[model samples]
Target: MERFLAISPKSQLWLFHTALALNILGMVLTDMWEPMVVGAIVTTYLSIDATVRVRYVLPMKKVLRELEQENASLRRKMADVEQSSAY
Candidate 1:
């Protein structure tokens, strides 16, 4: 599941659009609206999710990584200070 969700946003969008297109074609051939409606709903949800992830989640992840690195550096500096003062 994690691996499946790890797909890039561009690829996910392509998949959503492709699914919607297939649903549309299915509707045209069968004269049914159910599949098309369901596809549109699913596509809308996935698109919104991808947009949120791209706009917010990715940047926040970057910030988190930087913070983690900074935290590690600060910890090392504190340890060095403690060692120096131990003399």
Candidate 2:
């Protein structure tokens, strides 16, 4: 699960779609469908989870980056103020 989450979301979605296709093929072409069904289920879950997590995380990442930029600017301003006061 951790390893699945660690993979890129694009790759995860692609893998899920591939697994689904294979599952459908297996159902039509093979007597052995159990493994493919299981694979489809697992890949589907991973894809959904990765997409949802990425959706939640991206906005937070942007917000954190903005906050860091603001913090740096404030620090610079504080340094300038301190220097003027010393003079």
**Largest TM-score belongs to which candidate?**
1
Tens digits of per-residue lDDT, candidate 1, 1-87, equal 123567776687677667766776777888678867887788777766766776788789999999999999999999999999999
lDDT for position 84 in model 1: 100
Q: How close is candidate 1 to the true structure, as a TM-score?
A: 0.72
Minimal lDDT window, size 10, model 1: 1-10
What does candidate 2 score on TM?
0.60
The true-structure Cα RMSD of candidate 2 reads 3.6
* TM-score of every candidate: 0.72, 0.60
Extract clashing residue pairs from model 2: none
The RMSD of every model to the true structure, in order and in angstroms, is 3.0, 3.6
Error of 2 at 54 (Å): 3.1
Error of 2 at 49 (Å): 3.1
* Candidate 1 lDDT: 0.76
Q: Per-residue alpha-carbon lDDT of model 2 for 11-80, expressed as tens digits? A: 7767776777777787789877787778778767766776665677666788999999999999999999
